[model samples]
Target chain A: MKRYAPYIIVVLLALLPFSGLSTYMMHIIILMIMWSVIGMAWNLLGGYCGQVSFGHAAFFGVGAYTAGILYFKLGISAWWGIPLSVVVLALEALVIGFICLRLRGPFFALATLAMGEVLRVTAENLRDFTQGTLGILIKERTWVEKTWYYYIILAIAVLTYIVVKKIIESKLGYYFVAIREDQDAAESLGINTTLYKTIALVISAVLTGLAGAFYTNYMGYIDPEVVFALHDISIITIMIVMVGGVATYWGPVVGAGIMVVLAEWIRSLPRIGTAHQTLFGVLLILIIIFLPNGVVGDFSKIKRALGFGRKV
Target chain B: MTPLLEIKRVSRFFGGLAAVMDVSFNVNKGEIVGLIGPNGAGKTTLFNVINGFYKPSRGDILFKGQRISGLKPHRICRLGIARTFQVVKPLQRMTVLDNVVASAFLRSDSKREAVKKAEEILEFTGLSSEKDKISKGLPLGMRKRLEIARALATEPELLLLDESFAGLNPTELVQSIEVIKKIKERGITILIIEHHMKVIMSISDRVVVLNYGEKIAEGTPEEVSRDPLVIEAYLGEAPAA
Candidate 1:
């Protein structure tokens, strides 16, 4: 049953569009899948590698801009941005890793956060290049129907899941966990921690970049503020993984679903729409207090608390 | 015969203080050489220098006649030099078998081969029963054994055991001594830093004594034990005569 769970989920999701869902419902699903992609990317570096990054927005924004600039400057199809963004983002990741991977723990986190903010400010100031916060407009999207976008993101999510799963089961995965558990021991055992950490960072950054490129092609418009927002992109990515599960395979998927749905639900409330972030803040605090390891990580504890399991 | 490992006038300094000062030693292949010193006498520091954790401030280290003074730790490990921590560093959340397998992966590219090597090492270290247990949950004795299991999995030509018997009970100590003997039988040279005098004297083919970051004596274990300078360093200057 456990082995078949992923297949079951893929089958179910593949058939969901045939259920005559509203356009808005499809949008929510697409958003959920997209965020899950980002969350999984973050999980590879922050979860397995133990290098928490607060600057994923840097990669995200760079990816979006790669697509946006190609379309805006070259008059080319923005779909080209999807493949081209990988090159752009990998270079960006290399630079980021060189500078930030030298620092550990909160220092690394802060360095990434600072990098995101720097990119945002640079995007805003570079008027001719990034349109200086005037943002970029695709003018025409590839599809008028939401169905194609949903399917594209679904396919990407599946690919990301498979890639991450494979990596976590391989020797590289063990090396990552060893580094996370103890860097010194990992080094002594002949694992080059720096090289491995950079590999995790590059893979993570490229995946997140793909999601960002997809966002620009789908959303039709993007601004520096929206793409590079620290709290919105970077922190939310971390929160999605944290609220779901730190190191578990299914944590980001569950977390993204909950966060996206809760966000939409809160926004739909007329009187409390503005308080959605406050609700998220409260939820984060509660999760940290009661489930420091995140929901998936603390699943057994949660089950016991809810009185569903046998007494120990 | 050339030594399997050689330390030539090695010194490691932190700012103005030298932790290991011009300490020279050699371990011939297939011998157990014990390094005994009082607390803070820089025995572990010397081990650190030998294993490429620290660059010697003023000297050179050679493994099998090749200079390896400034190489990185992993590179050194890959060059057939492996060392355990004085404070055992197990990959805490990983199972004992997995921890050993990780080290075994250094020499074996195939995961199946690595697992086979890890299992063999586990059995040899007497940790087969606890193979599935989390490393952090193991008792001190077992954790120490896990450390040896992990180091051996690397298939080192020279294994440096840093205080492997530091916190063992009498039975565990005897078991560890036997294990070390078996490791020696496998024809791997060992340079061990041990605080227990009796254990060192019994197992070491030769002993080197350090006092305040300098070598005080080097001879057969019996000869070093009877050396007056070694006694003075451990017992403190005979009440200033």
Candidate 2:
């Protein structure tokens, strides 16, 4: 039963769009899955590889721009951005990794945080190229109904989940965890820490870029602030992983569900709608203090606390 | 015949201070060479130079006649040199088996093969019983042995042990010596830096002694122990008449 949980969950998720959810609910679900994709990507680099990056928005923005530019400048389908972003993000991740991976711990985090702001500023200044603050708006969306969009994002989510699982189970995953454990020890054991770190960065950035590309196609509009957002994209990506569980497989998914659902539900509440951010901040603080490993990561502890499981 | 490892006048400087100065030595194939020195005598620094952790200020380290002085630690590791740190570094959160399997990845890309190699190393290191336990929870003696087990899993031709036997109890010490001998019997060359005199003297084929960042004596264990300079290095000069 435990082993088949993921398959069961995926099947349930696939059937959700057919159950006649309101368009708003479908939108929220789509956002949940999208955040999960980004969360998983961040987990790969930060949780497992031990290279915490706060500049994922750079890759996200670049991905959104790739699709946006395709439609706006080249007269191509914005969907092409999905495949193109992989190549674009790989190159970007390599360059970013080369600069940031030389620093460790908080320094690496700060470097990545700066990278997002740097890209946002560059995009704003490159008026002819990125249209400055004017932002790209897709005049015609690929689909009018939410069903097709739902299935497409779900498919991408499934693929992302599988790829993350496969990578984490293989020898590459061991090298990642080894590097995370102790870089010097990893190098002494014949693991090329730098090469593996770059690999993690590229894979992570590409996955996040996929989500960004999908976001442009789905939402149909993106600007430097919306796409390369520090608080909205990068920080939320970290929160999703941290709240879900740092390194556990299912942590990000559960975290994304909580984050998306809570934000939407809180905003819909009549009296407390305006205080949602404050409430959300307090909730996050409570979670971090009590369940530091996130939901899935600390499930057993929760069960035991609720008197449903055996004590250690 | 070319030695398995040749350290040629290696010197490592931190600013003006020479941590290891003008050090030279050679370890023949299939020999266990002990590197001994007083507390601040640059033994670990010399090991660092040989393993490529620290670049030599003015010399070369030739492994199988290939100069490896400026190579990255991982590159040197792939060239068949594996080392244990003076402070044990276990992949703390991982199980003991996984820890060794990570090292075994050096020789095998297949997970099954790496796991098999790790299992064999764990058995050889006498840690099979504790293989499933998280390494961070392990006692110091077990962690020390796991360090050697991890290094062995890399399938290294030259193994550098930096104080691996430092914190072991009497029974663990005997077991460690037995494991080291068995490793030698398998034809791997060893260069160990150990302060445990009894363990080093008993197992080492030759002993090199250092004092004040310089080699003061090099010979058989018996010869090195009897040398005036080595004695003076260990136990300061007798009061002047």
Candidate 3:
């Protein structure tokens, strides 16, 4: 049953569009799927490999810009950006890993955060290339309806899920966990900690880049502030994994669902809509305090707390 | 035949201090060589240099007649040298089986092969029952055994044991000695650092004694125990005798 669960979920999601939901609801679902991809990507480096990144926006923004520029400057369909971002993001991840991976723990996180900000500023200043703060606008979206967009993102999410699962369950996964647990010991055992860490970074960066490319085509407008956003792109990526589970495979997906829904619902509330972020912050704090391992990680604790499955 | 590992005029310096200076020895194939010293006699530092944790300040380390002095730790491990830390470093979050499996990957790329090898090693180390348990909460003796199990998974030709018997109770110490003997029976060379004189005298094929940063004596356990320098290093000088 557990082995077949992913396929069942995918089939159910594939049938969701036929239920005839409103356009607004479709948008929310698309956002949820997209967030899940980003969350999974982040989890590879942060959770499994134990290299938490604060500059994931750099990859996200670079991926978004890859699509944007191909359309704006190259006079090509922005959809081409999806395939092209793989090559671009791999190189970008390599460069970022080289600079950031030398530092350990929080230093690595801070370095990544700075890398994200640096890229944002670079995108802003490259007026002719990136249009500076003026941003890139896709005058005509590819599809008239949200269904195609939903299917496309759904496919990407599925691919991301499968890839993350395969890597985590394989020999590479053990190497990653070993590196996370004790780098020195990993090295002693002939693991080559630096090389494995870079591999994790590259895969993670490339996945996030794919989502960023999808964002450009779906949203039709992007600026340095929008795609290269630190709080919006990077921090949200971390929060999703934190709220879901750190190293567990299902953590990021569950986290994304909760985060996307909570963000939308909180923003939709009247009178308090502007304070949605504040309310979200409080909720995140509470979750951290009560469930440091996130929802799926602390599910047993939650069951106990709620008085379910008690022998008494 | 050439020694399996050769340490010739090796030294390591920390600023003005010499942690290990001009210390040299050889471990021939399939010998359980014990390295004994008082506190801070560069025993652990020598292990670090031999395994490529720290490059020797002076001299060379040759493994199987090839220069291995400046290579990285992982590179050396790939060349069939594996070492356990004095302070055991286990993969704290992973199950005992998983921890060994990670090291087993050094010999085989297949996860199944690694797992099979890990299980075999767990059984050999007497850790099969606790293989499902996470390593973080393991008792000291079990953790020490897990360290050896993990290193053994790499299938090293030369195994460096840094105080493997340290901190174990009587039962664990005896069990550990049996494990070491069994490891030797497999024809792997062992270089062990041990503080317990009785265990060292009982199991070691030969012993090397160190004092302050230099090799003081090297011989059979009986000969080394009887050496004046070795005795003085451990028990200090006799005023009138």
Residues A1-312, model 3: lDDT tens digits = 998998899999999999999999999999999999999999999999999999899999999999999999998999999999999999999999999998999999999999999999999999999999999998888998999999999999999999999999998999999999999999999999889999999999999999999999999999999999998899989999999989988899999999999888888899898887788678789888999999999988888888884654
Q: Compose the digit string of candidate 1's lDDT tens values, residues B20-59.
A: 9998989999999999989999999998888888889999
Count clashes in each candidate, considering only residues at least 3 apart in sequence or on different chains: 0, 0, 0
Displacement of residue B188 (Cα, Å) in model 2 is 1.0
lDDT of 1 by residue, A115-184 (tens): 9999999999998898988999999878888988988889989999998999988888888988988988
Give one digit per residue, the lDDT tens place, for model 2 in A1-312.
999988999899888877989998899889999999999999999999999989899999999999999998998999999999999999999999999998998999999999999999998889888888999899998888998888888898899899989998899899999999999999899988999999999999999999999999999999999999998789888888878899999889889999888888888899998887788678779889999999888899899999999868
Model 1 lDDT at residue A221: 94
Q: Which regions of candidate 3 fall more than 4 Å away from where they truly are?
A: A270-272, A310-312
TM-score of each prediction: 0.98, 0.98, 0.98
Give each candidate's fraction of reference contacts reproduced: 0.75, 0.88, 0.92
Q: Give the DockQ-based CAPRI class for model 3.
A: high
DockQ of each: 0.84, 0.90, 0.91
Residue-by-residue lDDT tens digits, candidate 2, B20-67: 889999999999999999998999999888888899999899999999
What stretches of model 1 exceed 4 Å from their correct place? none
